[model samples]
Target: MGHDEPPQHQVVANDLRRRITNGEWEVGAKLPSRARLATEYRVGANVLQKAQERLIIEGLLEGRAGSGTYVAAPRERRRMVRARHREQRGGSPFRGDMAEIGRSGTWEAHSEARTPAPDGIALRLGIDTGELCVRTEYEFLADNQPAQLSVSWEPMSITGETPIVLPEMGPLAGLGVVERMRSIGMEVTTCVEVPRPSRASQAQANLLGIGLGDPVLVIERTYYTGEGRAVETADITVPDARWEVAYEFGIDA
Candidate 1:
């Protein structure tokens, strides 16, 4: 083909994609080698290789180290219901977050003591920029698969000397944000979230089993009490490929 013409690799890609979508090759079945396909398609080996790479990036194919490429198994898409946390309904923040979606979920968390609040965290928690705080990191799973991740911070001045000082330890272990605060005489009355799309970092990509730079959803949430004090703030992350966030609103007439 002339340089001015459309790339021969793309034509080969289209044909292969058609074969896959048409069920000519089932998932988990190895694909033909580049040289064989190149000869059969009357294209250069390099062109065939490029065509296969395209499918891999598109998530239609997978490449095993030292093993051949094969059709990728489909990934299941789950829903994350984003709504106002109603304490009256009762449960931990994560439990409530996943309630409307009807998915069975569990979480693993690590708590650190007396950590200095980062600049942005302090601003969100309404404390001085270098204030001491209790920090907790969580990895939430649904049906035994990684569903979401969150890192939460609470001002030490507020939680210090209280049983709920460490979010995932002491008396109120595993309690959601509101209940944990309420146990210490602080009533959480409001929750505000700012959500945006972000790219997956190397660590996040590894944990979420996705390629680096893949899109993920980021939500920044802050909880408040009846007296207007910021009690807790958290950064929540959800992988885009496996989850979708849905927002529901009720209009009052």
Candidate 2:
């Protein structure tokens, strides 16, 4: 194949996508067997399977064990806004984003206190490896469907011995990072975020109800005090198939 030519599986996937878009297969319509599709496309079964898998990841198809692949019903991709204004409003930013789109938002969180920070977490929090910190893992849901995942780390040096040590246990439970920190006399002023594309792990796939290796968006976020101290850091994951991330900023007058 030429250097610029698309891969064989991708070419097959493209044609299949076109056929699906043209309604060659209605929603929930079962596709032909892989052996037949392979023969029809004049490609090996592996290549055809790869193409079908790609479409499956794109939400155009779905596989059923012991059954067959079928056209998946179209899903509405919702917008997830990443804006500084959301944080300023306090409470759960995820909840507010869901409410804006008329979806009931809820989340399950588990916080562990005195958990030793790993190397990466320590680096993000500007603390030493194995340093004590409060670790919280969250599964955010929109209308009770898992929509996002996050693992957050907060250095114990700042919150240790304080009422806010356990993120979801104290009086500030469910109050966002900014408000929680403010209640303890910490003035959080700066928020930094770095977004990168990644694939879903088995655990992530189970939680997000997506196939393993499906595309996802991971955002590295850290909150800083005015004095430039890193108070909390987190990794937020959003499944690409069901959500589109949008960044918004206000222009200075």
TM-score of each: 0.73, 0.75
User: Evaluated with TM-score, which candidate comes out highest?
Assistant: 2
Clashing pairs in 1: 92-176
Q: Which stretches of candidate 1 lie above 4 Å from their native place?
A: 1-25, 28-73, 85-87
Candidate 2 structure quality by residue, lDDT tens digits, 1-253: 9999999999999999999999999999999999999999999999999999888867899899999999999988989988878987779888888888899999999988889999998998889999999999999999987899999999999999789998888798888899999999999999999999999999998788788898999999999999999999999999998999999999999
Question: How do the residues 196-219 of candidate 1 rate in per-residue lDDT, one tens digit apiece?
Answer: 999999888767666579899999
- What lDDT does candidate 1 reach at residue 195? 92
TM-score of 1: 0.73
Model 1 RMSD in angstroms: 5.5
**In candidate 1, how many Å is residue 63 off?**
12
RMSD to truth, every model: 5.5, 5.3
